[model samples]
Target: MEDFKELTKAEEQIMKELWEMERGFVKEIIDRLPKPKPAYNTVSTIVRILETKGFVTHESFGKSHQYSPKISKEEYKKGLTGKLLTNYFDNSPKSMLSYFLEENRLDVRELDEILSIIERNK
Candidate 1:
């Protein structure tokens, strides 16, 4: 997959809704949002921007368009994690794990679970 453009906060919010719904019109997306929902035109504009960024595509039904995510959530997660690893940890998995361990304060059971996952993966 090609590198994806980083989504703005609003774009990410809209994309999350699209990912959940699989597809939706702008009003449908807004309806799913938390209270104090954005204006219809604002959501519509951001969805169009998402399309231009190649993260979403629309199927037109006469005057209305239903949008769907072009990039899966998993795909975006991988891309974002890669960027984070490279930028903050010098592309080092060990460094990333060390940071996560120190910052998250995992309990012994959680740490053991993580070790088990590593062992299984190995």
Candidate 2:
């Protein structure tokens, strides 16, 4: 996990597709994408990068490959948040929460619900 590197936007886009599919071959992934899907070589290159990052792996089945996530979605999300905090929030959860609460435009009712969640957790 320590060896894992943050994904670029292009890599993240491909990863989102793999996350949704749970597992998929190259063609399946490309077909699932919206318009302007990445070229086969581009997607393949990103997939290999994910593999090197330890986020994904593939099983060999004859001539085709069945790719699957090596890490759970939750784990990947945690990694993303860690990056966000370190890069954008100066690693301060307080600052991040402050910015998010003020900038995200949550209504009062939504804020109350979120507060309730925090209270319940406590």
lDDT of 1 by residue, 37-86 (tens): 99999999999999999999999999999999999999999998888888
What residue pairs are clashing in model 2? Answer: none
How big is the positional error of residue 17 in model 2, measured in Å on the Cα after superposition?
A: 1.0
Any idea what lDDT model 2 has? 0.85
- Cα lDDT listed for each candidate: 0.91, 0.85
lDDT of 2 at 18: 91
Task: List TM-score per model, in order.
Answer: 0.92, 0.85
Collision pairs in model 1? none
Candidate 2 lDDT tens digits, 19-105: 989999988888987887779888888888899889899999998788988887788788888888888898998888788779976
